[model samples]
Target: MVNLMRYRAEAVYREVSDAGPGSGVTGREADERYSPIDILHDIGASVVFMGDVAEQLLGDSPVWDRVGVVRYPTRRSFIEMQQREDFREKHLHKEAGMAETIVAGCLPIDPPAGHLGEVAWDDVEYPPSDGDGPLMVIHVLRFAEGDAEADMAAYQTAAFAVASAHGARISGWFGVEGTIIGDGRRWDQVRFNLFPSRAAFMSVLADPSRLEAQRAHREVSIADTYTLLVRPAVDSLAASIQSA
Candidate 1:
């Protein structure tokens, strides 16, 4: 079996908007705006073999605008894709389209210990798991807006509370500056969180019961939110959820 690390990477890019902070686009519109990034995904398919895509869900990196997830057959495969000539060429366009982006590499630790949730859709059946499971290492990116420090703090506080209450684990959180995306804009902050499974993430983001928590987040969030789910080369590590 391949000792692969699963990843959930998030990228956020801006659409032509006159709105300022707190203006969020609906999930459907976000999908339309993110449609352009699909080309670069072909590269992941080329080397990674089996992979999935999570459109705009959350911004974790400093300058992230668009996010994607890749599951390579091996670490070597992951590395190889990054170095591929075609991928390198395609990346140029990806860089041009986005203002900023965030990416993370993660490992899913069973019995998830610490983590937080940023956003989750309203009605969706997330991947199954018992809630307490492995830590899925994740990389995140966010395009810098007005004040990253203040924005990140608010995002972390609200999101963490939501996730923690539901039993998730957060291993670490860090910030990355600048990116190879080649856009004139640079990233502001990058965050990290490890969850037992996608279900945990969904619970935090979707729970209608948490209306107060969601309302509390009104000030610190962007209208446009995106999320991507990625996995490692190894298949067995996939989290298994019980049938409802």
Candidate 2:
């Protein structure tokens, strides 16, 4: 079945620059050597979203710099690519550039239509003052023990209500299966939310109604969570990557 792979990478570029070095390969050169997107395109995998972290809303010291999601035609395609000798060779560059990373294979689940109907891009309210572009928040969650399904449902009901009221848009949601690569941290679900701006997101946090609604569900249902705010890189680089 079609599946999505989510990757969070913490790159260490101390030894690497945007430009390549002369003789010996540097970290930047190693990153250049990794061109899995081309191979992924050939294997019918499509980029979903790729962006860099702009802020950390709720989490320990931030370690990840970039996060990306790619959809593969089938789980087998991903496995087959990994089994290829050439693919293994290309992975060396990835290892060189990345200090830490996590790759999770997830299955998409279609929840009932959320209370907050889809908000059009134009309809989203911008900050009254200077601010960055649209903000995307990544939520990595682990549900409490016993009947994870029930916990998920409870959390979603309250979260959707609060999110809808706050004008937050759900960009992506998935149930994480397990780690496919990198650090073996386990997560139950992954969600992406788009806010009009940083101001809007902050407003959401301060909304008393939202807080009251979310308190009970969040506390009882979640065991652990991580939230990262990211600026969607909509430049040519992101476009090219998506098209690849």
Candidate 3:
């Protein structure tokens, strides 16, 4: 809960600035956008907001390009929020403005511990902790041929703990229910972790603890793992939004 609050405040502070593509939205304009989101803070507000606003502003309707996530304090709170008129009307409209969106519910994993080494979290003029690509550890996991529910629950339990301990700042995680594009298969679990640096990431991979955990997890958790070395670049037109 403490971590959630800290991150929320951080997001609000960081978000309420020239973070978006500069279409001339001054400070005052940004404040207006954040007003509604801020009021919902204490009502179990741990969410991950992501998308390519640039693409959005261009009027492209590419699917999965924009999203707003709201995390409730409990399942009950989530249910209540979904039922609330304000939540339904305002939230849905805000989302509809986007080109594409998907909403999901999930519980957090445990602390990630096994890692390679520590990187200077402050070295970069701008840290890619949340925006994109510090190092994305993508896992291709699948449940049993029939017992999908039981398999997913077990994977989440172990993944959360291990990820948190490894100093992985989880942006968010989700489970896919329907068929994925290109394949008729369904992905049971998806997790995203942003490491401080390449060395920091390697540390976890080489850790004895991580190795042991990997061995245990391989038994029932993962079908395959693909590492995408992504480095999200600040678009050429977005040069004015420089980091302080």
Work out how many backbone clashes candidate 1 has: 49
TM per candidate: 0.39, 0.76, 0.41
- Ten-residue segment with the worst summed lDDT in candidate 3? 1-10
How does each model score on lDDT? 0.40, 0.64, 0.40
Candidate 2 lDDT over residue span 1-244, tens digit each = 1112222233343345522454455444565577587888889876667677776666574356667777777789989999877788777667666655668888775555776536554555553234556787888888888765665566667666656754677666678877776445578888777776787688777767657656755667777777888787632322333343
TM-score of 2: 0.76
* Superior candidate under lDDT, 2 versus 3: 2
In candidate 2, position 181 carries an lDDT of 68
Model 2 CA deviation exceeding 4 Å by range: 1-29, 127-131, 146-155, 234-244
Q: Would you give me the overall lDDT of model 3?
A: 0.40
83-202: candidate 3 lDDT, tens digit per residue: 766655444323323222223344444433433224344653334455434554433345445444455455445544544454555543455444312224444554545565455556
Candidate 1 global lDDT: 0.40
| Number of the top lDDT candidate | 2
Best candidate (score: TM-score): 2
